[model samples]
Target: MSNSANHIISVSDLKKIYIRGSEHIHAVDGITLDVNQGDYTAFVGPSGSGKTTLLHLLGCLDNPSAGVLTVEGKAVYDKGKFMNERELTKLRRDLFGYVFQKFYLIPTLTVKENILLPFAFYRKAEADKTADRLADLLGLSHRLSHLPKELSGGEMQRVAIARALINKPRILLADEPTGNLDSKRSEEISDIFCKLNREEGLTIILVTHNHALAESAGKMVELKDGKLI
Candidate 1:
């Protein structure tokens, strides 16, 4: 583990491979990149280009089959070893907030409940206060008590965004955040991401096929056939 002054994440020769009975699929093949503090990076590529796979590796949601990955300058994966699950959980809990395309909120949980769900895994004394603030920020204050089924698709995605922010993570990892929304809703979500990166100074890394959203990023990385293009 090394200390990085500005580089929040550094990857070297990263690769993720899946093996079938007789085939080896190289989902992410030998890609190296760096994400600095306050960087809004979008991984954009066509389907099966390994954009999502690379994002997963960066977020520690999935482990790399081979390569080096350092977060905040400390090696998470190096020399054929990766951090244990507990350490990885701590790393994720402390540093990353993830928003997915599906808006994975529990149907039974209200907006507020869904937002504060992270507290169940990691205790935070200001959980309620944070949730309220995020709700207001995302314009979901009025829907805090509503169930997921009662909200529109955009509203549900906002709830998911609020839930991700409730942990006060330094890095926001989003995968196809606007994939389920219409154009208008997609633009709204895009604006929200821009605000989060510009105003909040959050380091954002997102995987998207939406070129417009990808264009809003400070850095755009295109992938093809599992490698940087």
Candidate 2:
């Protein structure tokens, strides 16, 4: 702990490999990383080098094959057993916010509805006034009523960011968040992450191929050949 009592996430000797046809292919080899609270960090590497695999492990979308992962200081994998599926789901809902390369908003739902989706499932009444604020902050106030199809790519991604924020997660795990966008658009998303890191103190773990994005972050880590090389 770096003098801040709140390290949003931590990984210890993490490993994830695939066993197929009696062969082992390491997607993520032994690696350890720590993301302190309020960090704006970037992970850069080639595909299959374990950037996305590590992000998935951090997001709790997938568990590591062998290692310890502690998010908000709670063990993600322990005693040879990962969190139960039910526990993982609840943990993801309560502590983690995810922004994927492809915006995963519900097409039929309005932007506002999409932002408040998780609240409907887990919490009774919506508390996404923060989502609206985020929309406005991300310059999407005008697109709230529009369905996803009516919005531009950047607009849809901004909505996805807002949806991720609705849960008020301590950690935001963004995987190639700007992967599908042009250079200028990608910077806009990076700017948002920087702003959140500065103003709201949200910890961000972003995986990207863009050097400019990496430059903007406070810390940068690179992975190669399934290891932090």
Candidate 3:
């Protein structure tokens, strides 16, 4: 299959199965999807509907048991052509940013430190200017020196967002990013995603159960029982 620059991710007949004793649970079955560059797509599903599993697979956090999965026109997982752990790590670090329901920031680190953690991991020089710019955009410039404990829930989530973007990833995968926030904070987070998508042309794939939040995206896909409906 040919890969297009506009298609950041493409998958066909993707399947992820887990065997528990004699039971075979198909977390994701026969999912064919394409995520275009700069596209904001949301996946909605009930609990146990394989939304998270699908996200994980797309993010290269997990391997599929069967199917073709490609990122940036390169096949990352296809039968015997799976990427190794180190390559997967590099792919995730350089190409993808992740945000989750919990703002997984280090409690002891200041906002600036937390945001720069990815640089430290990659042993790359700190991009203070970029960090500051992202902080300003996320409304966290004033909170740079503050620790996670001192920030409000919304502020913490913003910090998480900044940290995720520190690597300047092409794709941002958010799984229930607004799940822990109040309605107002949730809206704020949703607005941030939209703003980033519009201003920076960031490709975003969000998995959310909230109809309002899902509708904010340019595309909405529903998954039920490991299949798109």
Identify the candidate with maximal lDDT: 3
- Evaluated at residue 212, the lDDT of candidate 1 is 87
In terms of lDDT, which candidate is stronger, 1 or 2? Answer: 1
lDDT of all the models against the reference? Answer: 0.90, 0.84, 0.91
The candidates, ranked best first by TM-score, are 1, 3, 2
Worst 10 residues of 1 by lDDT: 118-127
Q: Write the per-residue lDDT of candidate 2 for residues 5-101, one digit (tens) a residue.
A: 5667777788998889999989889888788888888998887798998889888888689888887777879636776778778888888889999
TM-score for candidate 2, please give it: 0.92
lDDT of each residue in 1-229, candidate 1, tens digit only: 3335788999999999999989999999999988999999999888999988998899988989999999987788985898887888889898999999999999999999999987644446578888888888899989988999999999999989888888789999999999999988988899999999999999999999888899999999999999999
For candidate 3, lDDT tens digit of each residue in 110-175? 999998877644335447877899999999999999999999999999999998998889999999
Name the candidate, 2 or 3, with the larger TM-score value. 3
Q: Cα RMSD (Å) between model 1 and the true structure? A: 2.4
Model 2, residue 36: displacement in angstroms?
A: 0.8
Residue 198 displacement (Å), model 1: 1.0
Q: How far off is residue 216 in model 3, in Å?
A: 0.5
Residue 168 shift from truth in candidate 3, angstroms: 0.3
**Pairs clashing in candidate 1?**
none
The TM-score, computed over Cα atoms with residue i paired to residue i, of candidate 3 is: 0.94
Which regions of candidate 1 deviate over 4 angstroms?
A: 1-4, 120-125
| Candidate 1 lDDT score relative to the true structure | 0.90
How does candidate 3 score on lDDT? 0.91
